[model samples]
Target chain A: MSQSVNDLRVTRSQRFIREALIDLIEERGFDALSVGEITARAMVSRATFYRHYRDKYDLVEQIYAEAMQALFGAIAVQETVHSPQIWVTFFDHVAEYDRLYGALLGEKGSPWFVRKMRTSLINLIKEFGRAAPQWQSDSAHPISLYPAEDDLIPDVIATMFVEAITWWLEHGKPFPPQEMARRGVALVGAIFKETSTW
Target chain B: MSQSVNDLRVTRSQRFIREALIDLIEERGFDALSVGEITARAMVSRATFYRHYRDKYDLVEQIYAEAMQALFGAIAVQETVHSPQIWVTFFDHVAEYDRLYGALLGEKGSPWFVRKMRTSLINLIKEFGRAAPQWQSDSAHPISLYPAEDDLIPDVIATMFVEAITWWLEHGKPFPPQEMARRGVALVGAIFKETSTW
Candidate 1:
């Protein structure tokens, strides 16, 4: 237990560094920034930064991995597989970090930023698939013919959701995060109509 | 007429370069590549490569942009608002380019690729929103109560779809493209419950 607490502390410190780097990258393009700049802006020693990452690129991966883990965890907790409330939970999750996500992912219009977001999202989707294996096989009444061996359904939904968020952020974050989540759930539901066993 | 032909030539050359790059990146890794190496592998002159793009990154952006354009165009044609066929079309479009996409995006596992994919997907979702304004205002049903103004429905769906494709690619392209599309459409349909409209 003590060792676990120490591990948690190390993880927290690493997250702090990554979040600070994301903040800096949002302020200035990733290409225009440097390792020293990130360390300085993050207020961590260069030694510490290197100890955690080989370079800015590697740090970007770590940041992405961390963010994805949190996002997936939230999604998993809210995983209803076919419930409207699942969306409600998702909206709540997005609302909590709209500002940070809006800036880092919605803005910055950089190739690197976009790339990181996609990889993280993909990772999250795979987790979702694993979590909801029955989703592909439980075709009951109205939702019959669930493709038991394909991954297409998840791909389309995931792509659509990310695109909507990007649109919201790029268009100046016109709506509240909850609203965004609600609408997202609705749209997803619309695209993938629900069915009951009866 | 001459100018159009010239434009075609330019487009073809660009496609060739991108295709070659995708192949090379798959065999090795992006980090192990350089402009000279890429140009050499593509069998194009360095001068021609520079004329088309400033560097390898520029070429990457070009590929991303073109791929996105293709994807959006395919979606626009479907205009399903609430149909399984729409999902089918989307799956077909993505599966067609499985090799190139799987290598650069699904398998490469690069942050840069992820960012590019996200940005492209988001742009496509925005296009979908613009094209399907009805989706923004339809509240006759309980699912529509979220109000498009504050919703992130499009983003969530887009993100899911893209991620699913990435998952498919990484997991060995298990299902036939059309079967994959059918499953995707059905899954999303159940989730959204928009069957009455269709």
Candidate 2:
């Protein structure tokens, strides 16, 4: 087979394995399921499984990364400073992964999912800080004085947003996703506003 | 032996087992450790170990519960609110279990530990909601409403606070513990303030 065809085959196999693992996990908890079971379910050879993933944990991480990338990608960046549209985009983005997010953040969810989400959010904030010149302006007072230096601000805010969303999910998400997202955006905005003043 | 004396003996043995397990986790990492190893290290019989804990996971959960109880007990509750004092108390409480918290929330921490923390936090929040009266007010708007239903605000806030703290620990606590606690108080306070107005 040509190199491109081999690559496509490999990708297809990886996707098959990942989907199988998720199905297995949903049926049996992550701890209860063994990797041999995963391979058997995927109808793949042990060698193929090992070649694609170091272990079940690695495969889980890969699935989480794909979910995060897809979630982040859905949120289009604002070319201009329009807070409401940005908020709407943010809500829509979160809604895209609501099912995965619910499973990952639910009572029976894996801690690896939360950890992956936290890391992704931190990276996203750092990327935003680097790309947005407004984050560097002195007009913001305390925040301006310590933009990159106070990386904790973004980390804390991101954490709060994620936790609030998780809380909503585990408790049945009483409000519409858009409404929850709106509240989340407002909460973070209030936090940043306070910190900048401080 | 007297009933109290027998109780004391059982408690001491349990403590010894838990301490041994923690030491093993610190040295070998939680994933690498086993129930047999914990029993051997604690100098207790496998029967005794089983009597005290169903499994390694159960033992870890007990340790987590003890740490949380100690931390929560350390916080002083008053009839009237004093935000800064409350924050100071909360930080001091968390500092008491810094080692366990650090091990659980640190980069090299165990997945089991992290999951235990999240579950405990959720339970704690539910308990708080059950105990807090202000959460039941009907005037609160949907935008300002606490995530939990009537009398569940405390539980919701507690979960949110713990999740934020856990995230901070995993991502590298950028701010001092006191500052983080203060921020937590402020976040909860804002939610309450908004609800009252609504």
Candidate 3:
């Protein structure tokens, strides 16, 4: 009972800090942000802040790490790998924290964050490719149709996925998660056909 | 005769300065670089550098502007609008200055450059769409298949195109210009088919 109470306190404090950071970043960008401002905004003491995060960068990093882990975890538990539901889950996760993501991926955000997202997306894609050989063997996707010697397909798809999300978020997400997922799947399918014909 | 000589000298000085900027950016990134270092490396005096550019940012901006202008100019001259030759000219132009582009779009480069590239590509795409309605009317491409009310297709395609180039350059460009062109076209064509069937 005591441990559960402690965990709840920790979660609440972290959420406050994270929300504060997102609001501040959206207003003034990450570079100009400071710990004092974040703590003040979150109504938390400096000691409390330090207890949770090493610094602002560490705070942002932890937030991204936790969010991405949660996202991937959700996708992992899906009944089928690389299903349309995967994209739906991915976009839904993004939409859940739309404001935070928009700020992180906007012009105000750091390039380091963008690069981190790209790397994570690429690894996720490669993992999908491994788990489902049929995704490639069945010619269901364009990435699978690449020549054996060419290894840039993953990079290409990852880039596209990241940029699409960035563009969507930057534009205020004109489409809902389901719509985005549909368009995304259609894009990959289109690429597959183009590759096979070529 | 004197005017032509002055023009030649001006062009030579700008080239030296631009090359110096690329080399310095590749080595230490844009932030760590200084105007003094650029001028010293170019073997030009401060006065000569200022005569050609206001500052480092201006210099970088002008370099991209000229390169993009040259690329669009080449594409504009193509006998057929949206022809395969356009991609060939683009990839070829990129290959001609592979080192410069790689440096600009690489990890060390600024986000400002990436944003600029995205906007330029989006505009270029819109221009093509305007010049040739058949590109869409005949259902020849995926972008054309997008519902008239949906405007995100240009953004999606632009993001994909920009990110793909960035990835290719970062990966040391595994394929030649012609090959890259073919693959790029195939990717676009694939998206078309996906959109049509969806």
Candidate 4:
């Protein structure tokens, strides 16, 4: 019970620091931000901040890493691999953290975050491919029909997903979460038409 | 005859300045470069540099503008609307200016150039949509089969093309120009399958 209490306290402090950092970055700019002000705003001491993160940059990545861990954890529990449910779960996750997503991918936001997100998405895509090998290795979806080389297929899918999310965000998200998920699943279906069975 | 000679002299001087700027940017970076060294390297007097461009920023845009104009010029001559020929012409242009493309889009390169390239591509895509209304308006390809809204379609296509080129360049351009063009067209075809008739 004491260990659990300690863990909860650590989590609360970490969240406060990350949120404070983002607020400071948006208020001025990342270049002008300082660790001192971040701790002050978060109501945490400088010592606590240092114990949790190496520096401001490390904290930014940690925020993204935590989000990815939660997202993939939710995805892992889903029963179906290729269903629209997978995308719906993703869209819901994005909606839940809409502000953070916007700031992280916004025009003034750091490209470092966007690149990190892309790398994570690529890994998730590769994992999806493994879990559901039906996409190609299955007898139904012949590889010759869609001639993208083995190395490039995952990247192409990843780009499609990234571009889709980017458009949804930039356009003020005209479609609801379900609709966006629908369009995404449809597009993926189109790309892997021969393997739609998956 | 004197007027023609004056025009030729101006063009030569402008080209020299632009070349010098590109060389220096590759050696160091655009942020660290100075107008004084640029003039010295180009062997153009300060008077000539100021007469041609208000500053170095203007000159960089001029270089990109000229490249875009030339690319569009070459693309304009092609007869077919949806042929792979368009991408081949593009890949040829990138190959022709391999070093400049590398500097403009590589890791150390500025995102300004990448964004500029994207805007130009979006324009080209819009123009292509206009010139080849045959894809949909011609009545051969129905709208229902491909459900992307009209406004979003051009942006989607533009992103795909940009990401593909960006990938090719960052990967040391593993595939030959012709092969890259082939893959691009094939991917575009897959995206706009029902409308492939265009």
True contacts kept of each: 0.69, 0.21, 0.62, 0.31
Candidate 4: which docking quality band? acceptable
3 or 4: which has the higher DockQ? 3
lDDT of the candidates, in the order given: 0.61, 0.62, 0.74, 0.69
lDDT of 2 by residue, A8-68 (tens): 7797778788777667756776677778898889888878888878888788787777765
In model 2, pairs of residues that clash are B125-B155, B129-B151, B129-B152, B129-B155
User: Which regions in candidate 1 have their CA more than 4 angstroms from the true location?
Assistant: A1-22, A40-53, A57-103, A109-198, B1-16, B29-32, B43-45, B61-96, B109-147, B168-177, B187-198
lDDT (tens digit, per residue) of candidate 3 on B12-114: 8888888889989899998678888999999989898887788888998888888888887887788886666777888888887778788888778776677
Cα DockQ of the candidate 1 complex: 0.38
The per-prediction i-RMS, to one decimal, reads: 5.6, 3.7, 2.4, 3.5
Top model number, lDDT: 3
**Sorted by DockQ, highest first, which candidate order results?**
3, 1, 2, 4
Displacement of residue B154 (Cα, Å) in model 1 is 2.4
How would you encode candidate 1's per-residue C-alpha lDDT over A1-198 as one tens digit per residue? 134556865676676776777677678765677888877777778887787789877876765566667766876776474455555555556556565566556546355555556544554555544554344344454333244434454455565655666677666767666666666555544443332221
Global fold similarity of model 2 (TM-score): 0.71
**Best-matching candidate per DockQ:** 3
DockQ of all predictions against the true structure, Cα-based = 0.38, 0.29, 0.45, 0.27
Predict model 2's lDDT versus the native: 0.62
For all predicted structures, in order, the TM-scores are 0.58, 0.71, 0.78, 0.69
Q: Against the true structure, what is model 4's DockQ?
A: 0.27
Per-chain TM-score of chain A in candidate 3 equals: 0.77
Model 2: per-residue Cα lDDT over B1-198, one tens digit each? 235656875887788897787677667777777888988998888888887788887887787777667666664453423334555665666666666666655655676675556555555444443344453454445333444343334444554565566556555666777777677656665555444442
Candidate 4: C-alpha RMSD after superposition: 6.5
CAPRI docking class of candidate 1? acceptable
Q: What is the lDDT of residue B3 in candidate 1?
A: 48
